[model samples]
Target: MPTPKPSILIQLDSDPQPSVFDGVVAVDSGVEHLFRHGGVQPDAVRDLVYGALFTRGPADLQRTAIFVGGSNVAVGEAILKEVTKTFFANFRVSVLFDANGCNTTAAAAVLAALEGAGGVLNGVSTAVLAGTGPVGQRVARLFGRLGARVALGSRQLDRAQATVEMLGQVNGGRFTPFSTSDEDSLANGLAGVQVVVAAGAAGVTLLPEQVRRSLPDLKVAIDLNAVPPLGIEGISATDKGIDRGGVRAWGALGVGGTKMKIHKRALQELFTANDIVLDAEEILELGRTTLG
Candidate 1:
């Protein structure tokens, strides 16, 4: 019998210190050896990627994978782009990018919304509050991928419009830009909205209790902020699908379990192949399988 090769995972992070959360999950998900790099820049990614590629033969390359993570998603994105630039025709290791947990978290939130909508979002009116940030935009993109009529809510119209424009169209999913600076604007913009995802910053309230209760058509409300004074006034941090004002509400921690699952699953899957880039859409597919 041949000796089995050990699975090796190289974690490249743009932060000063790599995330302990991600490190713990890597261990928990059965990564045999973990190599970590911190404060990585886009220009500096090629050497590290080259080390991974050159160390293993073509068949054993599948045992090695790359995990890109950091607190700043933009920086991580740059590093991801540079990492891909180092790949040749058939000499790339599988890579997973989940900067600040955005990919998995966005996937989980969208899955929660799908569960709320009875497993369908095609043509559904969905509003993503604070939808210009990293997680918010990715959440909007995922929903748009699912064929939802998405409205991106931001304090500034231009920022919201930028996010909508970045997404463009996904399988003809419509994206509308709206403002959430004031109650009147918020109320007016969110008219006839069936689902609301509050992805605002911590301690910032994007959707008030009154406005939420007044939405006659809102069937689901997900608040992704896990701090004091949550993104949605009536949502609890531990809420996993609790009913709030006749809406299925999910809190940050509620969706976090699924996010972690998708994260670990992505890690476990890396050893299976060396050609995949597990980004938002791929993570969403993992979320769908997890939820199913």
Candidate 2:
């Protein structure tokens, strides 16, 4: 009889302190052992990955997993690429990159909006305000993947356009750049928008109540800021599927439940295969399938 292999999760974080929130979720997600590494750089990834790859045979590789996370998504992305480059053939472990809770949070938010829009996002016109950030870009990408005509809105039009062009290289979906800084820009960008997501920094108001009320085609509104002065003015941080002025609204806390679920599931899934990569699109699809 063979002893059962323990499931171990190695979390590599760019920040000086690895995320305690992620550690707690990994424990809750049934990871038997967790190795947390902070201040991780691309240079450190190869040694750690080699350690994960060499300690176990190919058959037991699924028991080990890698999670790349940090406050900065760019740093996390660099580390992820390094981790991938270390693997060849079946000498890899399943990995998930979700720095700053971007993938899970965005997945949950987009899934909420899709549900609010009658389970159909095809042909829906959507606007993702603050789309230059990690969560917002993912929201826009997910919406576009769902067949929505997505507008990536930002205070700087050039920044929004750059983000759109970056996302276009990976996905075949169409994304338009739009400005959402002022009243005129908001009105212009949000015209005929059926769904709106406010994924901005905390305490910064992206979409005002007046502008929200003015959009005739707005069917769903999602605000991912839980801090004081929520991102979307008219929506409460705790709102979930509440209809306010003919629009189904979802707040940060409202979307949090699903986000946590996706996070946990992504971690648990790491032990299921040694070849899967759980990124934005993969996490979005996972949430959608589980929710459905």
Candidate 3:
């Protein structure tokens, strides 16, 4: 009888508790022998990655993979860099960086917004509230890559600009920064926008129900906050494909199903190849395939 292929996944998380959400998804995606590490620092990634790299031979390396995640995308990114630095030639296992599920969540949210916008995203004027955040930054980046005129919003204009600059460095796409601290400012930032996505902090309302209802040009509205006083008010957590005032709206859970689907599909894609590194753009492409 042939020996069974090992399906081991090494999860390196920066949080104290290795994300229960990621763990559940990894298990559900058919990962066997998941080794989870919490409170992982960038400096410690070398040892952890080495552990995974050295244990399996090149041919058997497909059996092992790495997942970098945490609540903070910055730390997760630092860890991702360190993890990649440890890889040499064909001796590395496939690794995925989700960082609080930002990559998959943003991909799912973008996909939802495009669908809500009548299946058109190019040339659409879009605003990402709390655009300096991990998820918001990714959403803006993805939209910009898709040829959307993206406005990245933040409580402070400087921070938004910094995010826009950072995104430019990586993707060389155009992005506008706006301050959304007050109603007038947020309204101005969202003015003429066809798509509005609220990715603000938990339990904080970025766009009030009145504001969203009053928008004249808004065709799609999406909120990533599942907490009370959702990022975008007037949208229920369970709402999906609901039309309000001629605008399609999606709440957190509405987009969540898509996020979960993308997550699982990305994981399945990981196992298909030993050289795949599923990041934001790659994962977004996978999500787009699901749309068709």
Candidate 4:
């Protein structure tokens, strides 16, 4: 048999950070010949990606897959789309777009929501806080695709509407956007909702404890803010994947365990075939495989 094919992952970044280095480690779980380079400019990504493709041995290159990730989700997507047009059309290669672990992390969080809801996502009313952002958008999309009535919440009504439109395009109009800029609006958004996820910016509290406690119909509340001033109030940073109150609550760290698992598994999946594009739907399916 031929020597085991070498694998490589290219992390596209606007500004390099240490967190990216950790992300690389997770991606390298099943990959070989792990090489990293930064300072990727949108206008020049084609040649840069081409260089990585051709410089390595042609045989090893066949097993190679590209993973695009960065903090700037919109910019990262623009670059990845361009890269796809140039590289995928001309060459045979597998690639994935997972800016800020958006695909995998969102998949894990949604899986947690399903698990917290007794392994059923159909007909569930799930609320996604800060749903206009990258991760939040992916979570909303996944929830919509899984047959849940998704409430996409945002501080700006227009932004929420735009997000709902975008997600609906992918999910065939299954999500409804809600404005949660104030206490009353947030309370209204949470009304009759069974699942709540806070994917807002770091150091911001999107849902307060009283609101969480008042939701008698709530089944699970997951906070994806790993920073201080947790996204969902009353969720401790150290919370494990456990049940709390009448509703099961999960902090950022609580959901991270599954996120990391999905990330590593996504890397392994890149080598399963030469044509797989591990987007949100694929990532969510991978997360489901790991669920008990």
The global C-alpha lDDT for each of the candidates, from Candidate 1 onward, is 0.91, 0.93, 0.89, 0.79
Backbone collision tally, model 2: 0
What ranking emerges by lDDT with the best candidate at the front?
2, 1, 3, 4
Residue 182 displacement (Å), model 1: 0.3
Using lDDT as the yardstick, the better of models 2 and 4 is: 2
Stronger candidate by lDDT (1 vs 2): 2
Measured over all alpha carbons after superposition, the RMSD of each candidate to the real structure, in angstroms, is 1.1, 1.0, 1.3, 2.2
Per-residue CA lDDT of model 3 for 46-131, tens digit only, reads: 99988988887788888888899989889999999998889999878888889989999999999998888877788999999999
TM-score of every candidate: 0.98, 0.98, 0.96, 0.91
Q: Write model 4 residue lDDT over 1-292, tens digit each, in one string.
A: 8677557666666546524553555455866655554555578788867876677554555577777777677877887776776665436456677777788779988988887898888999999999999999999988888899999999998999998987777889888888998989989987999998899999999998888888899889899998989998888866765667767878888788888888888777776665667788988998889665
Rank by TM-score, descending?
2, 1, 3, 4
lDDT of 1 by residue, 165-274 (tens): 87885435389999998999999889999999998888999998998888899999999999989999989989998998789999999988888889999899888988
Q: Quantify how close model 3 is to the true structure by its C-alpha RMSD in Å.
A: 1.3
In model 4, where is the ten-residue run with the lowest total lDDT? 14-23
Model 2 stretches astray by more than 4 angstroms: none
Off by over 4 Å in 1: 169-173
lDDT of 4: 0.79
Model 1 lDDT, full chain set: 0.91
